[model samples]
Target chain A: MTQESAARRFVVAAIALAAAAAALVGLTLLAGASPIDALHALAEGSVGSRAALGETLARATALVLTAIAASLAFRAGVLNIGLEGQFLAGAVAAAAVGPLLSGAPFVARAGLLVASALAGALWVLPAAYLEARRGVPEVLSTILLNLIAAAAVSGLVRGALQDPRGDYPQSRALPDAVRLAPLVSGSRATAAIVAAIALALLVTLVVEATPLGLKLRATGLAPAAARAIGLPGARLRLLAFSASGALAGLAGGLEVLAVTGRLYDPFSAGAGYTGIAAALLGGSHPLAAAASAMLFAALGAGSSAMQRDTGVPGALATIVPGVLVLTVLAARARLTQKRA
Target chain B: MSGFFAIALLLAAPLLLAATGELLLERAGSIQIGLEGTMLIGAFTAFAAARSGAGPHAALLAAACAGLLAGAAFAAFAVAGRADPILVGTAWNLVAAGGTAFSYRLLAGATGSVLEVKALPPFAFGLPAAALAAFFVPAVLEVFLTRTRPGLALVAAGDNPLALEATGGSVVAVRTAASVAAGALGALGGALLVLTVSPTFVEGVTAGRGFLALALVVFARWKPLRLVPGALLVGGATALQYRLQAGGGTGIPYAVFLALPGLLALFALAAARGRGGAPKALGTPAP
Candidate 1:
């Protein structure tokens, strides 16, 4: 990238940060809280103490995994809006399978989690096939699929997977052995963050070093040229789609086993959309995507703290991300226009 | 019976109005994904206006203006600035959803219950009135699209902007106008929802109907003429699902029924085998 482009990106990032801060202020006022106090509480909640830092890291882990998933597909020119659905599918699948293997050892339980990831990847194959073979637009198809997935999962939880002890529509918690181990003592922050970071590095290496990665990026830049060079564009897209789904699935599985400890209706909480913003803000680079995810994670975790401490409604966090995405998209448009 | 037809007419009115506007916008080579947001803004504005002592017509007009401004602002970003229209539309939705809720809390003071607003009194021309409006509205829109001079220019802009530009028509102006009109019509749909269906404003009240209208436009292949049947088919399907749910039929999940329209569109396109040709320059910007 040229210095001009780098400078432009920095400007865009700065604008997004400023918009988020403004939104926070607006929301604080709307919620009848002091914006200054809310900001202080947000800062103190996110990084002021060790426990807060751990919570931030734990949230970042899930956000980063989903962000990486979104980054991979977006870099390859596919807009997989169904990541949220795929993430839910992965969580539900893991929740279903993890308890069934309670008699198995820890390694076996971990293997089941990996299998859940693959299951999530497999779930996206239909949409991928439709896009690659049938020329159906993935955006619309995936969005429709998301609605279907929500209803289907909700029904399953209500009908069969309902916990016997409670009427709440959710699956039973996973076995203790299947749960992810925490990285630090006295914190819920798990080894999943470490795994996500390693995966981000692996993604950076694959996209930069591997032949498949080169083909993927080539297809993303110019599909016609990639086709001319005999690059099997459809196959590559399918792989990217599945890999993206798998990463999203991994995030879901981690959330279920590590954070929520069970699968339930509305499992997503808009993580999929947040991941899209993270990937876009990060310019689809894996490491940058991780960093953006951390930013979002901090906002989410701190927003709750702000609400608790300063009486700001927690909706500010939700509102800020959408505004940030809009600002980033507009900035990107400006950049594209400048380049043209 | 008149009752069945009346109910059908009421159901079809909003869809027809919204789809008519969408048809115009799509014909100008710009799809507004923020129809839902535009409608929400309209609904909220209309309700607020009505609550603040404005007459029904005045409230409706205010809604239209709000929709027009919202649409124009979105077009400024997506069309003039060349942002991705989809993302811009989604942003509008996010803003509409959160903004409306925030504003509602501010105005209504967080009662944590459904709030009611005065509904527009329907213009009752008696027995023949509903039928006449339903048929006449779409018929007039169709004629305006195909027979008007600016309509031809708008279609030209969407179909082949370079050719139209060669002929000395401004594609951007036509598209912007169509976008504004589309926003107004979408807002009208929202106002109609408040007036006819629920008689109040609620969050996410449009309930994906705007998107369904978008799908209908594509299903109609940008033909205002074909849209009548397309709208009826969609409306009929929606009515059927509601009827089934009302009758307490549980064999098929309601979600499956809800997804039927999108699934049907995909299948129809697949069955058509890529032959339902879109405008040549649709979704491409004109220089």
Candidate 2:
């Protein structure tokens, strides 16, 4: 990249950080807390200790997975709003299968997790096929599918999948064999962080080294031109979308077998939406998206610390991402104008 | 019997208003997915104003103003800056969601399940208890969209921006205005929900109705004239769900019922087979 483009990227990042800080301050004032104290608390909570850092990394791992999923679809010109649905579906599937194979070996359980995520991708195939064949906008279809998935999951959890011992809408906990081993003994952080990093590396290698990635990027930039060059545009888009869904599903599966240990209502908690912002901020680069996801994970993990230390409400965390997105969007607009 | 219709009509009012407004915007070639957030802001603003002793009219005006401001802000991104419309719109929704929740906690001290506010009183016409306001509001919007020169210009801008530009009209200005109008109508929809429903503010009060409105725009094929029945269909579906759930039909999942309208809309669109008549440049940014 040129120095000017690099500087512009920095400017955009700075603006996003500034906007997030302002939003935190606004939220603090709204909640009758001192913004300075909240900032300090947030800093101390996220990175002050090794344990806090581990927790942040753990959350970032799942977020990075979702972000990668979003980046893939975005790079193929498909807007997969159904990531949220796919994520939930994958989580539920993993949660369902994890306990069933309590006697299975570790390798088998791992395979089951991957298989469950693939099933989640299958859940979105109908919608993707509809969009590819009928020209139904994926945006609308995916969103509607998300609602259906949410409702479906909610029903299953409330009814048949409900933990027999409890009345709450949650699934039975998975067996120890199915759970992802923790990376650090003292923290909730798991092997998923390492897995995510490896996946990010794999993504970078594929995007930079492979011909398929080239085709995908070409189609994203200009579908008409790509089609003119004899590329299978529709099939490529469908593959990208399915792969995106599978990645999102994998994130969900990891959360189930690694973090949460069971399925529950509001299982993903808008992780899919946050993933979109992460992908945008990352500019669809795997490593950058991973870093952005880590930033968001830090913000989310630190919000609780801010609340406890400075009496700021947790809502500030939610506001920060939105503020970041708007600032990034504005800066991107300015950068594009300069380029033009 | 009329009471059932009244309740259904009351429930349908916000959807009708918002969908009509969105219909106009889509007709002008700007698709706004931020209606949920815009409506939320409007609801909160209307609630705040009413709680602070503003009359119903003042609260409604405040809601419109809030919607206009939010819409204009979005326009600044999508129109002036030429940012991706979907990204900007989603950001607006997130902003509205987080901002409103934070404000709610601050203003209400975070205690109550529902934040109570004064609701707008229904204006009854002299015709045996059919409220005139419902019919009057839609009629007025229809006239504004079809009869006015600027309204026709807005549609033209969406339909053929280059042609409109050749005739000395600015596409951006028309789109921005349409967006603002859509926002106002979306906010009015939220305000009506507060007025007619429970006279209280609740989280997710709009509850994806704004999305349903967008679907209505597609189903109506971007015509104000067609949006009337489109709103009814959606509202009827929603009303049917509530009615079914209330009647204790627990065998079939309520979520399945909830999915019916959207699935049905998708089917209808598919059946139409590109004949549903979308704007020529519905998703593209204008030059």
Q: Which ten residues in a row have the lowest lDDT in candidate 2 chain A?
A: A1-10
Residues B1-287, candidate 1: write the lDDT tens digits: 45445555666667777888887887888777767778887878887887788877788788889889877887787777667776677566666766775566566664667767666555563322322354465677777768898878888988889888899988778888888888888887787777666777776677667766766666666676676777677666666666765786577765566556555555544443332556676667666
Error of 2 at B281 (Å): 2.7
lDDT of 2 by residue, B1-287 (tens): 46555566666678777887777777788878778888888888888889899987788889989888877887888877777788877767777877787777667764666667776665552111212344455567668768999977887877899888899999899999988888888898887777667688776677677767767676666666676776666667767776776786568765577666666556655544532578786656777
Distance from true position, residue B245, model 2, in Å? 2.2
Candidate 1 scores a chain A TM-score of 0.94
Candidate 1, clashing residue pairs? none
- For candidate 2, what is the interface RMSD? 2.2
Top DockQ hit? 2
Model 2, A246-265: lDDT tens per residue? 88888888888778888887
